[model samples]
Target: MEERKDINRLKVVLAEKKRTNKWLAETLGKDQATVSKWCTNTSQPSLEMLMRIAEALEVDMKDLLWPLKQQ
Candidate 1:
């Protein structure tokens, strides 16, 4: 079986921002479980949702995504 990759950096960003998944969920009016999924990389948010997340987090959209290449 193929290994799963962590694409979104939600967990790290949340930690850096001192925010919790539940707080984000409530802010977005979404279910906590869904926010947990996005944080764990078990699933990803849609582009539109990503925009909302960025807006709520006060960060750029690209900040939520894991960089494909390291500098």
Candidate 2:
């Protein structure tokens, strides 16, 4: 499978938004463990989930992918 840029970028944006994993999970209607996995770069959110996260963070999806630009 192709790697996802959203993993680490989501973690950073979540931090900048002052959102905890538990808060993000609740906002996303997901389990905290799943949010934790996303934060730790151990897993990725689906496209639908990524859209939700982008909305929750009040950012465009491109912002999440921006962090990967130099890589």
TM-score, per-candidate, Cα-based: 0.88, 0.79
lDDT of 1 by residue, 1-71 (tens): 99878889899889989999999999999999999999988899999999999999998989899654676
Once superposed on the true structure, which residue ranges of model 1 sit more than 4 Å away at CA?
A: 67-71
Tell me which residue pairs clash in candidate 2: none
Candidate 1 whole-model C-alpha lDDT, 0 to 1? 0.92
TM-score of 2: 0.79
**Ten-residue stretch with the least lDDT total in model 1:** 62-71
What's the lDDT for all of these models? 0.92, 0.82
